[model samples]
Target chain A: MTDPQRIWTAAAVIIGDEILSGRTHDKNIAQIATWLQVQGIRLTEVRVIADDMDAIAEAVNTLRAKHDYLFTTGGIGPTHDDITVDAVAAALGIEVIIHPEARAMLEDYYETRGGLNEGRLRMARVPAGSDLIPNRYTGAPGIRLGNLFLMAGVPHITAGMLDGLTGELEGGAPLLSEVIGSWVPESEVAILLRDVEQAHEGCQIGSYPFFREGRSGANFVIRSTDPDVLQSCVDTLCEGLGELGWDFTPGGI
Target chain B: MTDPQRIWTAAAVIIGDEILSGRTHDKNIAQIATWLQVQGIRLTEVRVIADDMDAIAEAVNTLRAKHDYLFTTGGIGPTHDDITVDAVAAALGIEVIIHPEARAMLEDYYETRGGLNEGRLRMARVPAGSDLIPNRYTGAPGIRLGNLFLMAGVPHITAGMLDGLTGELEGGAPLLSEVIGSWVPESEVAILLRDVEQAHEGCQIGSYPFFREGRSGANFVIRSTDPDVLQSCVDTLCEGLGELGWDFTPGGI
Candidate 1:
């Protein structure tokens, strides 16, 4: 495999009070991370902050500046508290404007319902000169401004928007992983795993241990952008475990 | 209640490659956030970073300086990949050493299973001058260094550590919440929620919309530090919803 200087990376800012308050459990971090991975873009960092405009703006500025791409979820609905667009716009030193296409879409969607009211019109607002990401689940569209995409807080709605955005991103090679699980305590085989990972040119190993079924066990996940390298790292680790007389499962327990 | 300039806040740095790679869904953020709320310490920010030493150390330094307390979960296990101890020690410019109590606990816990070997001895290591947070689920005790805590990546083990450290930290008044759920779409009642919240000082309302029972619904959570004020806010919100001809459920949907 050829050497690469850096991997394409994305950072997510989860904007909401519910998540931080623990009233609502956050699923967006995992979702966005998974989606970015499939696109060959690694999600490197995630910050869950409150709905405060200043906090949102500061986080947006910091993350967008640092990563190749940035995403924000929450505070995009048709409510007074939904302030992501305004916050993001302020951060970028731009104005918040109602996107005509978004307004038209909402108008059409609400035609049979109650029609677009002043509150419903809030969903049409976006950072100046931004486009829209289609939302098949709900009428309000996800906003996209350059490399920063603002999505929904709702898990299923976020999934829909992500689906609409699949393959729309430019990314590098996708990372491949192979998992090996064993009842052996991770401490017993830490060195073996590390040595195997070090021996492999482009692979890294992650150990996740758990106490389950009345026994201590761990799953070793070997990751590499190259599928062949990932496979070889897994094989080497498996061979070492076999030599140690430790029983392991190939696909994880 | 008097308006406070800043709430006692804490930030969490989840250090692991599994979470970033989406191979593992993070539960520590919610667990820690919930635990902090009960202790009157608001979990203001959470940054999930990679297993890289530089990233973990930088995040720990940045957040520890910003908040009253900072927590890190994951990479505290008995594996080579578990470098949280080494990374945090580097960040604090401290040395790493084996804590005698932790070593003794491991020795006792593993006496019948397997004696403390080199691999298991990894669990005994801690940053210089640190104390141990007891773990009932496992032998590896959580590390406590000043206002920073290093905890296990596993949910149950982390829970055990949290249980052991409950009420140990100093904090302010706990934030209280009241939930009012309705079948009405949030946009239809956005203005009402805003008006009620505006009229109620020291209170903020968050709207969470969901789809259930083949219809769209929303839950408005009113939060405040004062119980009387929280109750008043909930009462006002309920009155507003009733006036709008919407049937609502108390305590959320």
Candidate 2:
């Protein structure tokens, strides 16, 4: 029989030379991931590529086809390297066009700032048959083509764009998670974690070990779509840790 | 004509669940990218995937075949969730074996602490015909099979592994970059930046716009393999910015 619960997955292509060059730390991956989680979509994979058109197009095409939704950030500005629109259009095998609403927004925003120039006008370009994702912070609206979303590279601007798209997409049940932290080495409790996870049908446990303040510790994150399964798994894990003489914090360390 | 300079490229596959869940912010991508730059290798692409065997193996196979070198971080711990070795072995179509050296190191490390158990012993497992990358911080050495390097998920442990591999790989000329920051909107100077970049044969400019302290500004990073070309490009850009009556910081603001 087919699965009762539909799993919605998404992928993000972070297009920027600055990030690949290590000149800029990317904040969009986590930002978008968190946003997608809230939207009941799981972010399955993320690829960070350069500003090159071929690379951008290849990543966009490949990821957009594989996942339920694809999000791209960066290369949507007015600079020469801002070739996301062209690359995405090429990826979709379509022409790039200026959205009337986007152009009007740019014109209105830039009217008192400096008026639209060739560079500013470039912000209006998008893939053919696309809608606009509003950018409350910037004049340039984000482009949305089918299941593809092109957002700003700037973290706060991307945040604004994500805010605009919230509740607009259809997704499955949101994955729920719980964390338990303890001052114990993960190796000591590996078997217990494995056993507990296997015993719970839908729950998966992730162990994150850390060495802090001259001591070893770990935080166990348990995830499941079902709340009942999630709670039972957490209880079993806590019981197992207690049996092993380890103290664990429910909310993590 | 064959180019004398060989451009070395690398791709990274970050295997983890915490990162995908947005429960943990990834620090390895930037850290690895910066380290690769110092080794004169360009990190062309990076994929962050969940800790699933199929996902890990697929990403490994695809990226390792495409780039000069491939690096994977995460999923190398002692827990059941640490499946990087198995995934990588499957990807390479090799059998997993316990490296004697790694096993001995783990035994020695755990002698006073707790003695090697099944979980701790799991750290010694590696793909066949593999060499070890020294991990000074922990007993578990990173596994190196051919051009693939599997490192720890922890940032500090990964840093130690990267240190052990520095200057060991063959590479081309290191890319050099200079940044110029100005209190000007990028769109206002987009044409000048484009023209200046086009005039320079080998240099590529990346514009990063920012709105800070109630002012709009941008930092233009100019990169080139040749130091002479890089300096010339920077001089030309500074001159162009000056000609436009805008003052720019040489070392960036």
Candidate 3:
């Protein structure tokens, strides 16, 4: 919020073995990428590290230094493999101790169903000088230290924390996008595109070609914040492409 | 193939609107990652870039420079959304031309059918100075320039090209691994792991913790080529963990 014009960049460190081993398909990275894009935050790089202390430490240090924000998902649960808290603390040169607020939340969540033991209370560990990113779905609140936000790997829980974080933080303009698609060969219009791109200096243009076994076509997308510029570019590009024997339309299979 | 000691690394660049929109679940990245890992190749990075030219170009250039091999899946189809070839060509600073060999293959594939047109021939456009990575599933061959390998986004076709590429190249020693799992708390056994890591200099040790509802456990994996060192580390780590009221056994979910 300090500098309103500054572009926000983020990097994700997906820490788990289930992802690397192909045993569990990860939903966090893609979900986070989509969410961040909408907020005008660029997700520059993502590293999928196995649950290793050294590996986690290395990634945390590198990512935390490079990106504006570093979000680590997984390894926050109260399991034996959940060492992200300790590793992150080590990376930041801080001490991780059980926070009183987190402990109270865990205790309150467990009180309805008997109570939680010392092992279950492991979720209360927080690195020194960190604030809890309140988790709306469960008692295990995500912890944030400096620019690094550590949240649960579960899709619902991570999403819950993201909602809370998005409301508090400032972001850039949301990216605007529009798609124009049709069944046309990419070759015939390849040269014409070189000129369109040169002309549109502000917009980000994307052309995608597809094939469904027996059928073939291509899609052209114009993405920019300026609505007038986007509409004009899409219109002219479509007309130019249509003149070159392309079936330019709003949508295609 | 020149340096046998050099480990092979590949990055997956997934280009598609379907993937980004969550319309289609991606199976290609995991499939390729797992296959390459078994072959002693490390897949460290994966990028999902939309059908945008600038995005694709930027990702292509970065990944091509960083990794030993770059594997791109998607955006090479015959539909309107497939712009992978042209973008890749632009990224490599080459002209997108219809290669004689690629044309011949596509021609042969559709010789019996009449739907093949100048539009369908778009699949034949290959970047200059690139080898064709044969697609066993479809006649559409993937392009390989320098260390960058461009293949279809479809899981079957990507897997086919990957299989063919693996056979053609020579690689370093295959990575070997052993898992030491237990249903115990990590904090109580952290000291023992520190000792085991200190003793095992060569092996890359990793620990993962998981929990289902209230049940929790962790798996410690020691990966290295040296069988003796791996065995010794696994034995010591597992035995030490057992001393802390942990029950570790192989493949015990």
Candidate 4:
């Protein structure tokens, strides 16, 4: 997301059978990836694994060691199907313990609603030396075990955890981007896109095509850690598009 | 997605900068996963990586060797940024060659639209010793090199390729499922879900909670490779729900 020497990378482990079964469409991957960019960390890789404990441990252990940070979602709800905490603990070679603060928080939150029971208490289990990532909307706080952050599977609940983590992690310069949308089919200007991308060192361009308004269109997204370089790439692309006689929108359509 | 003893698993490599940058929400993972399930292959792992060559190769090589099958989506378009073919070729220690049939397909398809150009020809390239997966909608065919399937990032085009692939690969019995939606908080019925899942050796029930129509509700999805086990699990869950004095919708809300 920043200088080559200082780029911060993160990997996400999405733990759920529902996702792998295609019963639930994933929303956390995009949300977390977007949020990590604001924190100046590049979301380098993501793994969507099932609810299996061995799979969970294997993924978490592999990713947590390779990247600067690893974030996991799902398998931490009230039901028996929710076994993320146990799996992660097994992976880390640590004992699962009831997090006192989290237990207290849940106790207080559920006090006004239904009293906290054994099923709800499942939310309090975490690795022996883990900390809590605050959750504003729900009783269960996200788990932070060293470099690994265990979050909720629900999109909105994961948003609450991310909101609590804004500007918290150490990261490098933020990645900046500029998008140019045009009606011209990307194939028409493929050479031009290639030349522009090659001309910039710190920048990379992505072409996303869409069919809208009964015609083909594309959004050319230029990304770079350096704002000046990004702008220059955008300018050069715009000039090339102009020379090609393609009407373009500065942002996206 | 099938019998536990004969379970077949797959991993997907989503090659793109757009996905990691959060510019595009990926639809391919769910589509492929659902398709894989119907074929009795479990979608075990998914990796969303950048457009970098090394990253792509590392992911492809690692996943292709580990799983029974590996799929890749994105970076197969007609632009320079579309380098999935080259990257995958490098991964398998093979050279990138233009398949003559794919080249001819493009020539015929583009004859009525625009003449085939150098940019358009890029789609014809594939790893050495690869076969074609038919594309009924687009000119460029999907690539199949042994267990690795190189597919389009676009949803509908990938659908066409998948359609061509139906009943082609050997698979076990398909996983069956039944869903029961109830207007009860998940915490209230966690024990019931646990008991039902335990009673059925081969079945698993996942609780997906949602808030709708001024009430909290959950969908208990019971899944198993055996249809009878799945149905029994669903029936047991329904009986439990009835015993708990909770009304449930048979399918889902």
The top-ranked prediction according to TM-score is: 2
Q: Is candidate 1 or candidate 4 better by TM-score?
A: 1
The interface RMSD for candidate 4 is: 1.3
Q: Estimate each model's TM-score.
A: 0.97, 0.98, 0.72, 0.95
Which candidate should be chosen as best, given DockQ against the real structure?
A: 2
| TM-score of every candidate's chain A | 0.96, 0.98, 0.90, 0.95
User: So what's the TM-score on candidate 4?
Assistant: 0.95
In candidate 4, position A59 carries an lDDT of 88
DockQ by candidate, in order: 0.79, 0.85, 0.19, 0.72
For each candidate in turn, the interface RMSD (Å) is 1.1, 0.6, 5.4, 1.3
What's the lDDT for residue A29 in model 1?
A: 84
lDDT of 1 at A201: 94
Q: Candidate 1, which segments miss by more than 4 Å at Cα?
A: A1-6, B1-6
Query: Candidate 2 residues A113-230, lDDT tens each?
Result: 9899999999999988999999999899999988999999999999999999999998889999999999999999999999999999989999999999999999999999999999
Q: lDDT by residue for model 3 over B55-96, one digit each (tens)?
A: 799889987897788888887866445788999899888998
Q: What would the per-residue lDDT of candidate 1 be over residues A25-81, giving only the tens digit for each residue? A: 888888888999899899988888999899999999999999989999999998889
* Runs of candidate 4 exceeding 4 Å displacement: A1-5, B1-5
lDDT tens digits by residue: candidate 4, A1-253: 4455598989999888888888889999899999999999999989898889898988888888889999999988899989999998898789999999999999998898788988999999999999999988778899997788999999999999999989889898889999899998888899999999999998888898887788888999999989899999999999999998999999987
Pull out the clashing pairs in model 1. none
The 10 consecutive residues of candidate 2 chain A with the worst lDDT sum are A1-10
lDDT of 1 by residue, B123-212 (tens): 999998999999898788999999999998888888889988888988888898888999999999999989999998999999999899
When sorted by lDDT, best at the front, the candidate numbers are: 2, 1, 4, 3
TM-score of chain B of each: 0.95, 0.98, 0.91, 0.94
